[model samples]
Target chain A: MKLEMKDSPGQLVAALTPISEYGGNIIAVIHQREPESPSDTLGVQIVLEIAQERLDALVAAIKVQGVSILRLGEERLLYRQSVIMIGHLIHTDIGDTIGRIDATGFAEVAELNVHMPAIAEPSTALITIKATTRSEMGRALDILRSVAAEKGLLIVEPLAGAEA
Target chain B: MRVAVLGLGAVGKGLLRMLAAKPEIGLVLTAVADSSSACIDPAGLDPAAILDTKCVTGRCGPSGLTASDVIDSGAYDVLVELTPTNAVTGEPALTHIRSALERGKHVVTSNKGPIAADHAGLAALAEDAGVALRYEATVGGAIPVIHAIRDGLAGNRFSSITGVLNGTCNYILTRMDDEGLTYEQALAEARELGYAEADPTYDVRGIDAAIKLVILANTCWNLGVTLDDIAITGIDGLTVDALRLAADQDCTIRLIGEVVPAENLLRVAPRVLPRNHPLVIEGTLNAVMLSTDMAGEVTLMGKGAGSVETASALIGDLIAIRDRYVECG
Candidate 1:
């Protein structure tokens, strides 16, 4: 689960209370305090296991705490895919491209490597993203494709079922 | 995090000092044991007083309580196995770690006996119990070679591994090269400087290096190799003339542990390496050359063995376990 909430005291505990109330076994919680966006909000990524029947109730309970549920699933993000992009990454704003996928909360940019030969010339970047499920992985790829198309960057996506 | 240390040797005391130095980390040494006795406190104990008592009284814990009792007391969150290495039987240390894992406690060990003898078995046990059995200090002391292979170079295919594994042997070989001393003369000098043990069969006979190789082989390549599988040769036979001959050729003789997974070969023997070779590290410094497909040859060099150095590795493992617990929660 990915959560975005205002950075305030008791925000984390308020967010976690729903998991316990809904009988979800939390496997991990990656809480980032420093705001990474315009909104002064923290991103909390939680890995958990819960019954499908109780998910709706859990979501409702979490929403009651004024927490924006960016992503919620049965398991943690595990599937990984790497894509190579060649274009004016910095001038075209690669940060916006990554933000689009990351905001979806279905996938995260796990690793990135860039080769900037010159300031004016086109640069190359290798980005590795991880998602929770196979269907989510396909959606992440579609999101990347749209972003790359909008940015006029050539993308080399990972082959089907080849993503680590 | 609560901890139970099994040995009160130099490494164990060094670990206590490190833990005591960082009181804000919330890691408490709740239990400690020497071979003679054991001590336990649900709350944290005063490490300085414990050291003082051990030093002045020559007893680690109260009478009659063994290391096993401290382990099974259910007082510690992780078991710190610092007992001496017994490569033959993997003894008391093996049992200590096993008992901790069986009870669902994580383990961090510097003892190479259990890892060299049954790394696979112990790893399987830890997996079965959903805990960690980390022995980063068992091989390269403070170099973090195991962490480098398992975590830092994750997903890379390791082609080969070569290392100056034993510090005592490296010291003796360095002395022989610098002073043009004979094998026995170098060995005696190393003993006098407290570099080699009084009974230096393990270091001089290549057994220690071979054991470290077995640990690395089993970890990196999943090769279920043992001490018997390694082709061992020591520095005992290298004379001063050989050293001079290598020097004349711009080379130096050093005990090298090589592991080639492609050929299914692992050996610990003296090799005449060029002066510029990464393995030509001088004195007691150890270096491991990890030949990987992606990262190429990554050379990790550091102090191979010392109380504080080995304690640094142990503290790294402990903190890793602590972070794992924080994540798993």
Candidate 2:
């Protein structure tokens, strides 16, 4: 879960109360102090496991404390597929491409390999993307295709009927 | 499962004996090669009878089949590499490993040259081919140090690793310390006992220990380091006087391999350790001490090398692969 809250002494405690009240087990909480970007709120990411029935009440309780929930999802990634991308990978903002898929909280770029021959030549990379299900894999590939098309990159996907 | 073995040395034959002894493990020897020739049989060979014939004839196989031909035969699902160590080129061993992985065959090896030379590259190739490359015997003979670090302490990060890796060096040094013998006298005794090789440069010059250190460091830290990165000092220059002086100081001289990834330092040299130091192993025993975050300091010790001891590690890897394949299926 990613959230935004006012940078105050008791803001973190206030944001975490709902999780405890809803019987959610907190795994870890990452709260890095950085200057406010465009909004006057702090960004925090919390990893936790909670019962499905209490999720609605948990979200409601957090909003009662004026915390903005930026992202929230359960962990379910299972299947993985490895693909290769060839072109000006570095110049095309590879980080942004990965972020777009990861933002969904259902897929992630699990592994990566890149090769660059010269300063002006195109680069090649072997990428492994993992997802929660077969349909999520299709969504991830569709997102990758759009990103690659926008950057004029060539993609060599995993062979059909291949096991990962 | 079908298995092919390359390099029919002592360890190779030992592995065959163990496989024959435990046929329930489901590994069948389909091919085997010596230095000059190879024998291929998809239906499997009688391990005891073959050992007897090779012992009497001085070699095995049909005179002309090479290592490459055995790989190309495509009769096995796994390749066990028991070739000699060539730290300089990692030659035929490296080539053979690459060929097997490219053909999508799992590999279990006791050879350290290929691992010390190009482990990261081979690991990448194995990943691409979707096969497993296991080399537990490349380090401590039967200690299972690799699995201890990679699996048992999977959640912990290591601060440093120190070990007594070469048994031959340890045997020579132990004799020098206990019997007050000179380096030459102890080395001669080691050779007489078959502990030291005829040309003991690799063991005495610290190259063998250094190679094992490289393999462990690369695997543990994913450093992609080569042998040239380490600073090595062997026991060739240590004299009896130094050993006596260490004894006076309540310390014994032992060759130690130390790696500190945080400082990007790897060194192997004769160091004076207190008599009680965990790494101060006696005789041919090998020990590795890993300083971990969650588990404190974990030390593992066992026989470092022998035909049967090394075969134990090879068979352990084979079983691990088989179990994983079953789980995945």
Candidate 3:
């Protein structure tokens, strides 16, 4: 998150202490100062990890410290998995297939590299999906499996290790 | 110790050749039977002569006798059953192994049928008869996975057994991935190389791998899962584009059989794995990864099947029986 607080001695510490109180881990604190520009407020960038449920309270707590929130960029999806799907993808409404995963709210179809052979031949696609957690990724795959089964398509999942 | 070998197929012939070559092992063949004939010599039959006759005439012994006759003759200390697997019924091999166990004779088999069909029943019969029933050649040929679980990792609890248990599927996938061959093209190449059968349905359809997984799952965790319990998705209609897609990410596809007893999950499917993963071995080679409490992850790789490779497993079991059971008598 980026923050703009009043340029003062204890203002930086005041902006940082509430973060730890809310059980957030501050990974890095970037304080960039410009020698040319004279501004009353200081620009600070913070990168941290916190539980999703505590994020709202964390933002409110930081705002109460007289710091104006510049921008909050939280990566909602962290877990990624890739699968291969084969069948008549275009004929089966490919948009609807991707739409189902995006509709899950916790997961989204990130990328798809499709290979189409001759006309009417079965098409193959490599689909990458990102989810908020491991179980959410699994649920997304389950959704894809049901969709594939309905469309007479074959879904190839990973023999997952920690790396896969 | 006296031993009788049933069936004169490649596995049977390979066992005889090993016995003939290794006189130091001191395994005396008392009776030998092919599908059409049986030869018994309580004084100890000659292994080379049996193989020679089998090679020349395609029949190992005299006519008008079946494998059952040799089993009832009671002329051997251990019965090595190596008949072709009957995936559905377990067949004559099942009855032969049961008869031997009932008669207080040690039974060792490379056949997956009887063991997959009725492992618990046969083991109980062996225990009641005070004999040993060992089928090390069932799952991963020459890999000694069953023995490793029963002995080396005896106390460790396995959470899952995942592996490329079928060679025909692996071979086809390997060729397709390496050379960019279509499924039919790779299968044709596999058949030409004798790595696949004419029918190929049993292997390509994942039924062969499922049988092996069922045998291991029942043996290790005693899940009582049969072939039907497994959710099988074979490599029969796999697209070459799938392999290329996997390759785009430095990954490849394999027909993996996985058994996670904790999840009550048994499945055989084409699973994606990294190129360097232990289970991503190429060709007809078999690989197994056992996740256990004590050992962490144990990966075993070896030849899945060959006449001599499977014969090696039979010999190990035979020698084990000799040292532990036969010699005591």
- DockQ of every candidate structure: 0.01, 0.01, 0.54
lDDT by residue (B123-143, candidate 3, tens digit) is: 889999999999999988989
- Index of the highest-DockQ prediction: 3
- Model 3 chain A: weakest 10-residue lDDT segment is A33-42
**Model 3 TM-score on a 0 to 1 scale:** 0.88
> lDDT winner among the candidates?
3
| DockQ-best of 1 and 3 | 3
> Candidate 2, residues A1-164: lDDT per residue as tens digits?
99889977788999999899898777799987566454567899998766555778999999999999989866656568765566788988989988988887778899876766578666656678888667678799889978988997755443223232
Better of 2 and 3 by lDDT: 3
Question: Across residues A81-151, which tens digit of lDDT does each residue of candidate 1 receive?
Answer: 66666678889887888888899776888877776756786676667888866667778888987887788
lDDT of 2 by residue, B1-329 (tens): 78899987989989888887887777888988888888889999777777776788867767888888889998888899888878988988999999999999999999999999999999999999989999999999999999998888998999999899999989888999999897899999999999998999999999999999999999899988888998777887655655665565466778888899986779887776777778888998999999999999999999999889999999998888888753422
Off by over 4 Å in 3: A1-73, A162-164
Clashing pairs in 3: none
How many residue pairs clash in model 1?
0
Q: Candidate 3 on A8-28: residue-level lDDT in tens?
A: 899999889889998877879
lDDT of prediction 3: 0.91
* Alpha-carbon TM-score of each model against the true structure: 0.66, 0.66, 0.88
